[model samples]
Target: MKNVKARYLFLAATGIAMVACREPATGKEHPPSHHAASITPAKAHNVALYQFAGTPPAMAALIQKGIMTKLKVAVQLMQGQPLPAMSFYKPRNRYIADSLLVYLRGQRPAACEKIIGLTTRDISTRKGEIENWGVLGLGSCPGTACVISSFRGGKGKVSESIFNRRMITLALHELGHTYGLPHCPDPVCLMIDAKGKMNLDEGESYCAKCKNKLLAQGVVTK
Candidate 1:
């Protein structure tokens, strides 16, 4: 795999706006049923969080809390299953993020309005000409499921505050996609596209326009 830092700088310098927290179609140009019929604005209340095996408990709790507080939704920690072996790309030693979304949606309960998968292992998806592009997270746009990983965010030298912020920012960003929010042009918005860079610190929260959109969708009360 290409070095993460180098790829980030390359994309940032090129000003290439790669999809952030977006999953390619579950099938050929069509999302899966769960994605297609995800919870509506008013129904987006309960969320199921799957802590995939090997993910840290503290991290999972933090994610759950972050989502609950930021999105103003109920988050329940469900039983975590093993990451699908089929999603693993042996050569890169990472899980296919799109496949992981499929797995996560399948595991969602009927009662939960949405679902998220958390893991420590690396996850990736295709980006432009490059196949198996590593990503911090991937969420189905206007769909029900998403996945995030700590492998990339926790790498290198970072303070605990920065690391925690990165994790929380990723969770909120992916969930924002599921709530039908697109990548925001505002640099400080939580929904800003990463554009193939590790600039989580640049995002503080949802911008006013994005927050108003979420408010209209009933995803967040405040």
Candidate 2:
């Protein structure tokens, strides 16, 4: 058996991007989902963020605006939807990340380039080549959907200020994948894997290398 690289994770109080599975960061091309549907946008930068019913609304609003301004994208804070029970993991009392992806795929807005669901529930994926428990989030590239959970950021352990930073960092990290970016080797870059040690650091913006790639791909102008 091939040795799987173990990603380090912080002890978050509650919660969780990327596909349910990840290939090694050796820059190999993984096949795209042939039936994956593209999301249309009201404008080039339009991004739709769906807040699942149980998530904290106030925090979600703040995240919506932050994403809009920071990434130079137009983020729409849509009405909350009840998380589907079909995604529930009875043992962990968490939802399955892929189920949310499947849900978001069907819920894309006509004027949005990507659709992301925000929830407070813990989420996980059981399909990685190696066992993965309690993931921070998951996203698929060239797909219109992704999701993030604030449940695991270790409630009350993180100061309001730092909590916000971590949320935005992971938000952009997963969103970057939706724009077809891979996990960056730079520890301080937003594209670093959330489970990486770098996330425990204070930086929240994309590194220059990633910023230029986004510009080149037309995912972001600024």
Candidate 3:
């Protein structure tokens, strides 16, 4: 009798332990029907270009206006949507490209799909590359977009009218670079070389080949 009682007690204890192990902690079980659908990847990106100081106020405004106007037109042409808001940042010192990138990361906006930095230095140029030794604006981590910088200066003292015209072309060019575009072969296109020219002549838009390229990238429509 004593042996049977001990055996019964051991069996009961094992059963209790097994039950406890199998049961999940309260509130830990996931809902059976609440699995969320994966978020669709973004096809187009909205970029915010931050301008650091050292650029003249008038020049900055011209750059901003030109970029905004061309970007709007580009979106319309592409049949794509624009970000609800685009912004600029002013830092006390020049070359705040890194700081601006850090700032955008902290904001954590879903709408701000990308961030681009516009500086007076050529990011692709060797000199600017050396200067940006410790910078992080070249690109973001995987699933994030890249950052592109452009240099737009030559003459020491350009007239206001000329600067304004130059701003229009430069803005379009830089924005094009941001959108994964390269310089066009066509001399008349806005994305053509700007070694000495200041602006694009009226009625000159993206060249046929460039337009086809943009269309392929879903950046422009027929």
Which candidate gets the maximum lDDT versus the true structure?
A: 1
Task: Report, for every candidate in turn, its global Cα lDDT versus the true structure.
Answer: 0.78, 0.69, 0.41
Off by over 4 Å in 3: 1-45, 73-110, 120-124, 127-158, 194-204, 216-222
**Residue 47 in model 2: lDDT:** 79
lDDT of 3 by residue, 1-222 (tens): 223212211113221111001222467776655444564333543444444433444555555566555453211111112211222222312333333334434432344444444445332211223533322123322112233333444335676565466545655554554444555667778767544344444323667776665566454567
Model 3, CA-based lDDT: 0.41
lDDT string for model 1 (59-142, tens) is 888888888878877898986978999889999999988888878878987767678999999998878788879999988666
Clashes of each: 0, 13, 0
lDDT tens digits by residue: candidate 2, 1-222: 112111112212221221232222678765786654573322456678898897787878878877876676778888767999898888778898877888887887766777888988888865456343676677765456778888776669878877777777777877776766667788777777655243634457778887886776555666
- The worst-scoring run of ten residues by lDDT in candidate 3 lies at 13-22
Pairs of residues at least 3 apart in sequence or in different chains that clash in candidate 1: none
C-alpha RMSD between model 3 and the true structure:
21.1
Pick out the ten consecutive residues of candidate 2 with the lowest summed lDDT: 1-10
